[model samples]
Target: MLTEAQAWQALDAVEDPEIPVVSVTELGIVREVVAEGDALRVVVTPTYSGCPATELIAESIVDALKAAGAGAVTVETRLSPAWSTDWIADDARAKLRAYGIVPPQSAAPGGGQVVRFMSRTLPCPRCGSTRTTRLSEFGSTACKALYRCEDCREPFEYFKPI
Candidate 1:
């Protein structure tokens, strides 16, 4: 029988469908992992309740554990406390940057980030230019925002603060 640690290790291999740079574990989606008897139960929370990845993420979790040798896997989603960026592992943050998506700065009390400055400056992930401006708060994805890099003249998206 595999231990809880082994189960987590198996989960670490499951990458986020939207952002493959980090695993669902690093994204703070998978909250709890418990092995009871021959069955393994996992608790997951979506970044946003309406996020499309919710269902896919849960399926990935179950598939991952089962592939790891668990007799049975149960993926549970918990929305009570909600998911926060604070749960993101530091290593995952670095991976986000390396993959060109700037990880959120910090987790605000509510669902948004604590805006300390006037203008939010996100460097262009493509051209490394700070001349990026927010085009819109919404992007193709629910969790990102549209941005345009003036220097590179390329349109990109900011992962937004969570």
Candidate 2:
């Protein structure tokens, strides 16, 4: 039988396919974990509906839980109450910064509204410079934007706020 704590522990090792440095749990994708007898069910909310790594993430979750002694595992996708970047763990933000990717800023202070059209400068993850310019709305991944720092002349990706 799999315990809820054990299921969660297994999931904590499941890293995001796109961002290897962070686990799905750290990204706030794993919303719930339920263990019933030897079966386990996990509720996940992707960063966006069209996220390319959604399938891969689901597979990873199932594999991890099964390896952790679950007899059966099911992953459920929840789209309602859509995922928010504000859900990201604080420690994950530091890990993103260390990995040279700018983590998304919180939108809670603004009533959970993010203005996508407005151009805003994000500090460089490498040099901590506000003199940065967005090179493209999309970066290596759809959830990230390409940016370059004027101070260090380093190109980095900024995780877009949902």
Candidate 3:
């Protein structure tokens, strides 16, 4: 009979499969958790609709809660409001930058305008410099962009804002 708070703590312990340093909660994917009688319901929003790690994250949540003595844990995926970099916590952003991945910049409010083509000026996560060049639009994953710092001359990945 774990409380909702307890269940959240348990799920927070479950790290993201791809980014082991950040937990699923920190990634802002765990939207809501409800204790329904003998079962716990967890709502998750994927980083992207086609993200391959969504299933793994769901499985990790279930395993974590069950291991914490929670009964009948259920994971629900919600795609309505979609996940955004703005939902990412401050602590998580710091961790992401420290982990050598540039945390996404906060998008403008009501940013619904479609762009035909736009170049984003991103700061280098390693050298804290604005002099950087985009090496590729896709990095190790579809959610990231590859960049190289002109100052430090180090190639790094930038988590694209979505």
lDDT score, residue 1, model 3? 70
lDDT for 114 (candidate 1): 56
Q: Write the residue-wise lDDT of candidate 2 on 51-120 in tens digits.
A: 8999999999989888878888889989977888899999999999999999986563346565666568
Worst 10 residues of 2 by lDDT: 106-115
lDDT of 1 by residue, 41-84 (tens): 89888898789988888888888888888888888878868666
Against the correct fold, how does model 2 do in TM-score? 0.91
Q: Best candidate, lDDT-wise?
A: 2
TM per prediction: 0.89, 0.91, 0.91
Instruction: Write down the lDDT that model 2 would get.
Output: 0.88
User: Against the correct fold, how does model 3 do in TM-score?
Assistant: 0.91
lDDT of all predictions? 0.81, 0.88, 0.86
Q: Residues 1-162, candidate 3, lDDT per residue (tens digit)?
A: 789999989977888787777888998899999999989999999887778999998998988998899989889989979788788788988898999999887672366777544557788887789888888878988788899999999999988888
TM-score of 1: 0.89
